[model samples]
Target: MPKVIDHDQRRKEVVDVTWQLIVEGGIEAATMREIASRAGFANGALKHYFSGKDQIIKGAYERSLNNLGDRLAAHTAGKRGIEALEMFMRFTLPIDQEDATAARVLLSFWERCAFSPEIHGGYDEHLDSWKAGYLQYLAEGRADGDVLTPTPDEQLVDEIIMLNIGATVVRVVSPDHLNAHVLEAQVTDFIARLRRAE
Candidate 1:
């Protein structure tokens, strides 16, 4: 019998390798040849899994978003109110290697979005999903009387999103100015300000 291949697994392996390359050296580093070589596949073999570099990058981008979703779920599970909001905010900070990698990779994709329509569309959707998730958590806090932000829901959500993005950029580009503790404290302080007096 001829050897059987797991196509989905191979594709995931390729995406993983590509993501690592992006994390280490930005999106430009994730070329088809490099991905195939690093993924232990022949150059032509990668074409079987992905039509080209664009497809591979898209796959890797979605994988990173999915990862963010999973981490948020894990952190926010069995929690609500300010606790859940804080947990979700932690996902935006460079609290560890995983969060740092995701933020860096996302930054790279955002740059690419200016040039690639495919990346632009996918990134917009991914961003919408994140915004929706944050809104849900914030709404929960408000319903529980913990989030006392007087701003409209949409504006409050936008401010939170901007804060997280700003924090990620500062930490990723100028590490000396921000550390995990500082990031966590910033989030905690923000949530504290949102609390309503009993």
Candidate 2:
């Protein structure tokens, strides 16, 4: 008998391929043919898993969100409050090449949103989930009295999120132009202001 493929696994395989195609070749190079070729599948094989390109792209967007969420969960395991916040930030900011590729693919997904409402909606949901989790983290830190900064500025924390995203984008576009050491210091200091006396 022919090998039976796991449907969900195959779907993710297609999305994983979609991610690589976009990352290595940019949006234009992510045509269906390219994805299939790069994925080492026959032409139109992706269709068995996805109805269209947007379907797969949306899946990849969710995968990316889950990817970050998983990393943050692992990084912040057994931690809480200010430490949790720092761990979250550390998982987000580009400290190495592997992290940078994930960051870069994410930015590319944002640009893809401009052209597809499906993608835009998917991206928005993922971002809102992240932001909501962020708000909760801040609120919990404050309640725990472990929040180090002067109380907490909700707007400022949101700005910090933006700063993180913007900085990572720069690293993606101009790898040589970005200094991880500088970014690390800036981010660490920013989080430092949020700590309470131990």
Model 2 regions more than 4 Å off? 1-3, 148-152, 196-198
List ranges where model 1 is wrong by over 4 Å: 196-198
TM-score of each model, paired residue for residue:
0.89, 0.86
Highest lDDT model number: 1
Native-vs-model 1 lDDT?
Answer: 0.80
| Location of the lowest summed lDDT over 10 successive residues in candidate 1 | 189-198
**Local distance difference test, each candidate:** 0.80, 0.76
Query: Which lDDT tens digits does candidate 2 get at residues 1-198?
Result: 999888887787778888887778776777888888877789977878788887877777677778877888888888776678777777778778877877767777777788888678776776677677667777778788756566446774687679778877888888887777887887777766667443
Candidate 1 lDDT at 139 equals: 87
* Model 2 TM-score on a 0 to 1 scale: 0.86
